[model samples]
Target: MTTEDTSIEQNDDELFEHHAFTVDKGQAPLRIDKYLMNRIENATRNKIQTAAKGGSIYVNDTPVKQNYKVKPFDQIRVLFEHPPYEYLLTPENIPLDIVYEDDELLVLNKPAGMVVHPGHGNYSGTLINALVYHFENLPNNSSERPGLVHRIDKDTSGLLVVAKTEESMTHLSKQFFDKTSEREYIAIVWGNVTEDEGTIEGHIGRHPKNRLQNTVFEGDDIDKGKAAITHYKVIERLGYVTLVSCKLETGRTHQIRVHMKHIGHTLFNDERYGGDRILKGTTFSKYKQFVENCFRVLPRQALHAKTLGFKHPKTGKQLSFDSPVPDDMQQCIEKWRHYAKHQDAK
Candidate 1:
């Protein structure tokens, strides 16, 4: 048993949390750095690599590097610098839409327009806040962010998983590594897709000149991006806009929206990517009215996480959940469909 040592006190700036976690097969045999990347939410491989090289990572009491292989039963220690908020604020109750719940995990249908967590310039109304509030007794992914196993965009409503226990979080996260997790989304695009089904395979990376946009390039470096694959089927073609079911082959930030835009079909009302043409409502009254009335151009990308499936981390049970499109998106589709039909009749 380790003895308490509060005699050595640290200042606010000096007190970084040291996390201890066990390695299971979900983490075994992979490069120690990537394994750490797999185990932690939002922590990347580069972060782990830097920590290992800087002696902030220890496996069984020895500092290791990227080459170290994780093994079951190994006690991994990570000394990561937690921001000042870690110890200062406990997670508070924020209302959340719970889709499914078990002892090990909880699946939430996060509404569009809720930030996943509090970050720079954002101090309130985030998914993590809700997780913390709801799972008040549950441990966090680390000491800072509470319970989040994965995320969806603030304005993209869909299924998200929060781990109730550390072991479950670790195991479920590896499914993402093995590409076994089932993630499906629904998106409304600006143009109709003639093809009933198709796949867009592109190398997606940061924009060359426009830092905010994602670009698909053919060059070898391709900016060293992950090969992003999106399998999409036209679910409903409303003459102008279309509802598409998107199955993610690889998960990336802003993936579906960017990939669709790359294929000349940005999401309906994506001001950032589609610019003028998609947004200009010369005569679509319902859309124009919405823009001019209650909601402005501020609606989020019309993407929804309709389904997510994965094996239970502790029990290995195949778990799946599905949700209908939200009311706003439903109204958008119906209004667009009516306008398209009227235009066609003319």
Candidate 2:
């Protein structure tokens, strides 16, 4: 898998950029920070040094200090947290599924594969770019993602609320920060969960070995990452896979995905978390073919933002919205239901 962690959404306010380079065989030995500054535009030696100190710079898969020399054929990779690209916010007329619209706010169902905002490789055709073209005078936060109070993963389909005015933005953001906003997600994960309802409580942080994915941290290392909590209830059992609903108390990066995987039930088809293969079920040829078909039908993670509830930013009235699962997920679930039924008969 080619690092789909870039597609995962995080709670951080800053956007991160990842870059990689291969040193030439005849390359001259130089300080890694100096070499990176020469290749990357707008890069300062201080910024590169900071990234190295932060453990975001790697030389040949090993974290190296800024003063480390670049050797011939050395593979260099760097991940840097940068402010959103201010100059890249051009209005593009990409279509949006606007479910509700008002002067102060707009609620929309974002489809899978459409990034919420411009970041790194995705500069155009984002929800923010569409909002900028469709609406006027949206509030611009510190980052370039204008009016976005929260975000869903790029491969997770679901509902999102965008603030239209500064007052609404502040009010809505406070609701999310306070954990008062109601957000529910529906997911299909590999294996049958024995628990009817359970809560996953742990600290979530970036993986120590692979910075691409999030891992649950336990023991006395409480300060390593922010506290995250997810409550889940099994909705249905479909032999190899189970449908479940998750409610998040803390919206950390990849919270649901990471928590579910921690319990040995990775999300169905979530390639980034090792759910794309046959995590469960028999190894018969027919079963293997059936799973391959399911993967084909649902190419992305089998998760969706189903419902959202919060107080009205201006009116002080409670508001809520719900969406049906997308067609692809619906169809995949039905296929599993049929397979499970047939397996029972046999």
Candidate 3:
């Protein structure tokens, strides 16, 4: 028998796994589940059965039951919603700022500059490493990362919800997937936003030329990207920058950053999206020096995941949590506030 295993990485919020196999002409008939068990690594019988139930197993393009007999020359394929984890999970003695913990789940405040999970070029000191060490037998998500339901960017500080049991894992994942959960972010963007409140809608996808960034597609090319929506309200208007609260309707990768940039208000100091440089303000050397000082104060993007609301997985009761803005971001905001006030008084 010959087997081919393939994994494709996507730039979006979700990842999938695909596998294919061809039965040898001389092979005898065997149960499809058993045949897959012998060929696929780390696949448990229960897992295979669950995949079969979900119609993820197929023979010659037709979904099949686990007990179906595999015939010679049959084309078998298996699809999974999430890809297998690439790196081994190791426990590390990293401290976690846990906000709330119960039998089913926990919510924590993750600091900036911390990767959520291990991936290429980042093999250690991840949130998953800390999770494995602090808790025992935490449930694995579809991607096989323990307890993770969603993630934020490495440089974006935010709140995250984690599952402790299998039931909670399945339940909480559904809430995110169905867009029933509420998430609010606070961001300081470069420019004075004219509107008090508005909604930005566009298709968000990977940038064709730049693999590291995502862009918004519109009009005739809308089909190229997935639909994303962000509702933003002006919280305060600085002289050259604006503070806004953004509510996510669809949790696409970099949704707020891309959508805001599409409208010409990129997040302040977000280096990847070109917000690190002086996008607004006068050309005077003193003004330039002041902006540079603000950049140094907030080295990363001025965005924070401030509020999260979701239904309790086990009890079906509603729960909400809020986090205070980190000190660095708060200090930077204060500086901008003072600068705007001084400019108005002059």
Query: What's the lDDT for residue 104 in model 2?
Result: 92
Looking at model 3, residue 16 earns an lDDT score of: 46
Candidate 1: stretches off by over 4 Å = 1-90, 137-144, 275-298
With candidate 3 superimposed using the best TM-score fit, by how many Å does residue 193's alpha carbon deviate from the native? 0.6
Candidates arranged by TM-score, highest first? 2, 3, 1
Clash count per candidate: 3, 0, 0
* Pick by TM-score: 2 or 3, better one: 2
- lDDT per model, in order? 0.72, 0.86, 0.87
* Model 1 lDDT-worst window of ten: 1-10
Better of 1 and 2 by lDDT: 2
- TM-score to native of every candidate shown: 0.70, 0.78, 0.76
148-221 per-residue lDDT for model 1 (tens digits): 66677777888988888878877877787677999999988877677899999888876543434667877776
Instruction: Give me the candidate number with maximum lDDT.
Output: 3
Over the full model, what C-alpha lDDT does candidate 1 score relative to the true structure?
A: 0.72
RMSD (CA, Å), each prediction: 11.7, 9.2, 12.9
**Which pairs of residues collide in candidate 1?**
93-133, 113-154, 113-155
